[model samples]
Target: RLAGSAAGWGFQFQSPGFVVAVCWLLFLMGLNLLGVFEVSAGRLGQVQTGSGRGGDMMTGLLAVIVATPCTAPFMGVAIAGALGGSPVMGVLVFLSMGLGLAFPYILVAGVPGVASRMPKPGAWMGILKQVLAFPLFATCVWLLWVAAIQRGVTFVALTAGGVVLLGFAGWIYGVGQRRSMLEGGRGTVAFCRVVAALCVVICGAALAQGLRAAPAPVVAGAVEAGVEPFSEARLAELRAQGKPVFIDMTASWCITCMVNERVALDVPSVQEAFRSRGIVFLKGDWTNRNAAIAEFLKAHGRDGVPFYMYYAPHQDGVVLPQILTPGIVISTIGK
Candidate 1:
């Protein structure tokens, strides 16, 4: 929050490289869960450390970083408050949030006999572990979709190729592990692992180059009919004309934004209401890091996407809830 505030709160969003890196991590994690490879006490899936304390600390840090994006929309209010207030207040809010996040784990750890109550090891456990890989795979697909929206098809192709290479590396590494277990051909096992590591490095380097390439042009008027691309000047013009306007500040990577649009904004009833009521729907795409959109979010005391504002004719804009229902939209416009 402090870093974001220092940069005018626009840098709160992740970069294209960060998204691609996370997608790769999720892909590799899925492969690990699917029995493609084992890290053998390495810091990937089912991570192991010689010292339990270091492992626990690293795992906690990793959890916080990964979970932040998923929880940002819901935590916007508190985050905004933290950013807008004093440094002490900001620290308190974050400290409170961390405590809240750790509470469930603390509860589980503190309780006696919790592990004893868990079902004994069985075939079902293996099946469940494999089944869990699908969600990781799905999340990787979603991130790639977000990448497509941000950079274009070429970016996705590059990322997809990287994913394939990662899979190949995993397979090769797994083969080496199996051979080494039989206690023969140690030299061949070492050679296989070296080759697998090289493949991973090559994939990472290629992806880095792809991300550094220029993004595709943002085509105007490509959105759904009746929705206009948002611009500050356009907003001012509409407001000057005493027209009602709804500003949707969203990003492709924002899960809550997608959910709200699907459940409320994209519905027939809401579309009809928008047409009949003559509301100007202006959408700001923050899929890529945009300074203008960042400024707009900052003006509204927000540091993240999924921000919604409604401007009634001749009135100040009214901020809406993070979660929206069709009824909420219809009623907000009807008034």
Candidate 2:
């Protein structure tokens, strides 16, 4: 669905993005931990709870949102193609994608024997729910690392502090809920509400402060050594002059981008090719949002960072594969 609306669909994929997604997932998990889901589902969280279809839909939605959809193999091409076409086509494509993803759940729902064979609800379900939260927390840690790279140490510390504050608030809310449940006092519930409010306020203020302090300009030089900042104007000028150019749209957070840089693009032969052929290496850092690169990606049937294209003299841009080889670069651009 995101790709279907790709023209104006822009996401920074930054710390704030990570925090919002993670926070929501944590909130849902908190509810699950506190037995909100179980109670609502009549203790088993089973399909017979009257929201079977809704639960399946939510699962599909969460899969799309929590996981970066474009990173999957062939997903970029499918979404990119969908986005480039008419709106109706795009929507159909997205719907098809959703249906394909949800097929497994549909199968289980349709087959009673399959559902019956599933693990019985027991005390272990609670343990499994808690264990699942760890991956989300680990994701928070990864986002903080990327944030440090984009901003600085202070920014990272502030973001970390915000996480700590959120955890403290959750703890307070948990305690408050416990007291309210056991004692059934209006005072306890009121105190819990107050703490939740404070948590929201403190977290917002901390994030705002971090943003204000982070004036670090997104620089191409910061992307990698000897790579020029990408601009459409510069690229056009070079292409008009019949000069060869290589474009790298990447983000620090993209592991594929880093791996490609280290293994293929930054190798001696690849670097030497640029020096010999005068391949103007321009990098668009999508660590932060840039509308130009976003559009460019869409134009080339690509939806995200780590997209590579080579514009040869007197020729249109040749879109390179996501995974680059030293020989691929040397032969394609070196010649």
Candidate 3:
């Protein structure tokens, strides 16, 4: 769940078209954390809710989803190598990630010893579950900070407010759940539950309004000072003309991207290399979701930003290491 939350808040939403989805998801998680629907659904699904052969097929389906947002260390190198190979290899590379996510559940189903040793659910389980919720909460806070940096205070305030509303709704729902559990009057429990549901609905609507009404982000136009903006059409045009192009796929919320830019890509020595090598330094500002850039990243087995690639004159591009130094950029251009 921490992975899911971080994936949504940091990696995925750096692009456009993902904010609403994250907001909705965070809201849903809020409900879950508050114990809103647990009362209705009874216990959570089995460790093997979808573990049989047929259900296991969904592993491949979930592969790309899990892979698409985690810019983990060594992940880029492995993915780039796979993408540089055959299509089958690339699919396998992606499927591996989904399989990892489903591994825990699969293990319980496949290994009797593991399942037999598992502690039965009881009051103690609730304590552990609540402890897990803290990590999710921390992830949300981290995401809030990231959102502020990328989308600004207005967006952060709106989003933070929405999160608050979801929490309030969850608390109300939890109150209702406790009442019912305590065998309180059915009418009172029903009233509290209905009220809680209403709160959640209002939160959804409020969030939608905030998302739609939010102002467009302002680009700092840093490239006019030196760098060139990167686009699919522009990149193809340059490459077809036998130009040397270095593409930087970056986002505002990406710490790695920022450090790379400051210490390597944008340094004075690297800028000189660009001039000497006649390299066209094109920047893909993945600070917001651009479908073109997203597709380009995926084509190379990348699920998130901070992608660095070099296209030599009339040649297939090469994926550069995600971690960069000035020497690295200069050396690549000299090639």
The prediction achieving the highest lDDT against the true structure is 1
Model 1 Cα lDDT, one tens digit per residue, 1-335: 44543432223334767778888888887888899877522344234445556556665665676566567667888988887789999889989998898887777677867756767899999899889999999988988887777778888899899898888888998888888888778997999899899998998899888867888764422578899999999999999999999999887777888899999999999999988988999999877666788889988889877889999999999988888999988888777
Q: For model 1, state the Cα shift of residue 297 in Å.
A: 1.3
Please give the RMSD to the true structure for each candidate, in Å. 2.9, 5.0, 7.3
The segments of candidate 1 whose C-alpha lies over 4 angstroms from its true place after superposition are 1-14, 40-50, 86-88, 113-117, 218-221
TM-score of 2: 0.74
Cα-based lDDT for every prediction: 0.80, 0.69, 0.67
TM-score, cand. 1 vs. native: 0.90
lDDT of 2 by residue, 279-330 (tens): 8899987776567887888777677767888988998778888777898878
RMSD of 3: 7.3
Q: What lDDT does model 1 reach?
A: 0.80
lDDT of 2 at 237: 90
Clashes of each: 0, 0, 3
Cα TM-score per model: 0.90, 0.74, 0.62
lDDT of 2 at 294: 79
Error of 1 at 190 (Å): 1.5
Which candidate, 1 or 2, would have the higher TM-score against the true structure?
Answer: 1
